[model samples]
Target: MNSFLSNAKRSCGEFLSSFKISQSTILHMVLGNNSCDLDSCVSAIVLAWFRSQMKNGNEVYVPVVNIERKQFRTRTEIAYLLDHLNIDSRNIICIDEANVRELSNVGKGFFHLTLVDHHVLLKSIEYLQTYVKEIIDHRPQLIELPSRIKCNISLVGSCSTLVAEEMLKNKAFSVPSVVETLLLATILIDTSNLSVDVGKSTPRDEAVVKQLSGKRTKDELNLLFRSVADAKFSVSGLTTEEIILKDPKWIENSLETIMMSTLHLDVREFFAREDSIDVIRNYCATHNLLAWVALAPVINQFKPIALYCEDDEVREKIIEKLIVSDLLLVKTSDEDHARSDVKFLRMYNCKNTRKQVLPLINEVLQQRSSNLSA
Candidate 1:
């Protein structure tokens, strides 16, 4: 009855007629990072958009992380839309921890398969590429791939926002109030509330959030902020080594001595609990280190405040000064600020920092060698 819903119906009819996909065709809805709000929002938008375009008896499959992981929250949104349209639930397939190899083999006979994701896991992308007729992502790598795989990359704030914008353009699904709220939450979480240090907010995300939560209360913003802050670091059952390797960039540099530098206490708990700094120092003391850097990215007024230290003493001295300078500071007995320091090295993609720091570390190694010779 509303303009948005009417437009959604019209768009779905047009797309179904255009694609010529029959009611018997199976539609696979693959999602990544079920724990992430952005992923959940994107999955809902894509499923709703597709449902609008199809008729009865078509199948929709959703791949979840685990049955108990609560990835199926998107199902509620999907149900809302489907119920409005009088669609049946029997046609939807919700698979959890699915074996990709097995699913591909099973879907081989199906006429149409579509995959949507924002996560940049290479292995998952390759697997989906094998059978997925269409793929949507914001990762630059997906855009670089060959043309046969239908890939759309907009580099927006959140992949869910991107999909919603696309649907809005095509007049596909009704942009429901809840869908809009989810999109706004995803953008805020992903962009660190549009802090410049994390990178500027994507225009698309900004526009959608503005359109959805017009004149949001301060309490609402605070609640959203808390939700994201709580999810930023997960340390349960994780070793110091495991935490370091969580980022893919760090995994690639596992063989080399990577320099991690952070403002002293940010990762003090992690380094101390895992005993990683000692491990790193011992390893660097023995092996040939290819890279090393200490980068302290201080958040001052929502911008990156960088302080570079090439030597351990220099870093310690600076941190002491910082503590004395009225900045709320905590010192670590573990002395593994280097681990958090190096973690950011991979995060900001600063290869040049490694080039600068390694030489200084090597100098320290050589100075110790000269002292031993004396």
Candidate 2:
């Protein structure tokens, strides 16, 4: 176990335990995005540690995982990496119902926030937007933050890359190898082992891996990537519902709501599972979603963009727009010709991700609504 992570674990526990609403010192909270993936959690944990070690950095920093602590197990890769470092996930500060209320009640000017891995403030934490002191993310700036807040937004494969740069810039640049390995592993997994074919890796991401990987050979790095990715994509014990909820991204428009989740297993195998269809329908109903989009990654193309919706007209319109648009959708060979209830399409434009698809889907939905009004 690296000494820094050990210290971080202890420090996070101590701070949370000692935190009080009446405490004189403001709680400097470092938080990641709601998804709480490996990159998000690592960035939060490491960036908080880095800031706390600076001169005049006596104000304690607490790394807060933005999800409920119970959901920590659902973040398999995060759990695996922390456990490997001998850092118990239980020791981490996670957002719970009680914690949310407690922090929300931390009177104005009594709390400070640093956002990582995400820029836009969601409704859950919008109350703390004015209290935000720093913004660090690798995505396009989506929200207008206060002028006084220090912004470090840039385009990179992983937000971890930006956090790694911060760690490197510190004068007292003594970071533990376990911490380095954690950052490197996150960048590798997010960038697909920094493969040129995947095209997600930027120069900064590559540099982080090259520098932090140390004497570990190419094979060692590859093994590390597989270990983390295996944990990330592993669904051995998870039920179908758990798999769908693992990394869900919600898309809501005035006309409808759609739930999109990454399918770690093969799409065909997923569809064949018992009660899978019922689960999708129930999930949609429970969340008031009009549809569900299940995406599975392929080596060269995004194969099998699956859609589950009972509304034939709505699903077909979205499909038609995608087929003619930049996504370059084509029907799958394994498409069930008899199954009119589901639609499976392939996308030739492998570079575009959900970030790009979400807007396009929204546009399609908007147009359909306009045409109906017309």
Candidate 3:
């Protein structure tokens, strides 16, 4: 067994043991966001490990948000990362593996939930807000969490950067080599290795990488980023629906639900596949989504493209919102990039991410809902 993972599992066992005894069970559940992106997963695992090292004698379990064991393969990058680090998923607890409703029934007060990666509580598990003990995130502070909860919300590119700070402050850097590699790789992938033009990373992210990056230069780390990007973009055998699930983001409110997928493949190459539209429509229908958005970077040029499908009025409204995003991107057309239900808008300067788009999407939904209510 890998030394770090074995030690991680030992903590899991101790955490699980507390659940067996209902009388004085104190379960410290560290959860990543529902998106379960690479940053979320790594932050949850690493932070839980650090907590265990604190020797609180209480149980600490890190649950991989919504990714079930069966759906694990859809997250190719995460799979690549864990496999590369010699971490076994069998030893970890996933949301599907544990009965969440049962866990909730155990009394929210009994569980101490520490959130990593996401600031807002997902609607699906909003009930757990009462149990939240701390929040460590990179996104803006959108919600008013409990005053007692330890909130470390910031605007860094990666939440893993914050977790790295905790590890360093706690003097828990004695973790195994594989763990170190995973932490460093996560920061790189999330921040594009601290690229200034991308403007996603902060000085803190760069400092954390420098502290953790031993014997590796910035150029060498760029090489690591390329390898990680290759792993992230490798979606050859996956079905179009599976591709949609790969890095999807969901924006929902009281009145609407929008499902958006961000693809690393070139927009042209993705639609060149015959069944892309058909599968996208199928996913939208299955989920009863009001709008479906796809964002991809053009091949080689790295230009951005945003694609969408839904009712014509709603579609046009979304396009208008994006146009005003001030991304300084032009809108070009490609019939091949469109189908009966899908429309593609090419972008010149591609700095926009789903993080920016989510708010725009929610605004449109809010307006539509308000109009109807009026």
- Candidate with top lDDT is 2
Question: How many clashes in each structure?
Answer: 8, 0, 1
Cα lDDT tens digits for candidate 3, 70-172: 6667777787878876677666566776555556666755667889988676577778777888899998776577789899998988999998887777563
TM agreement with the true structure for every prediction: 0.52, 0.86, 0.90
**Candidate closest to the true structure, highest TM-score:** 3
Of the pair 2 and 3, which is ahead by TM-score?
A: 3
Model 2, residue 47: displacement in angstroms?
1.0
Q: What would you estimate as the lDDT of candidate 3?
A: 0.74
lDDT against the true structure, each candidate: 0.44, 0.76, 0.74
Candidate 2 error regions (>4 Å): 1-22, 55-58, 253-257, 299-302, 310-317, 327-334, 337-339, 362-374
| Pairs of colliding residues, candidate 2 | none
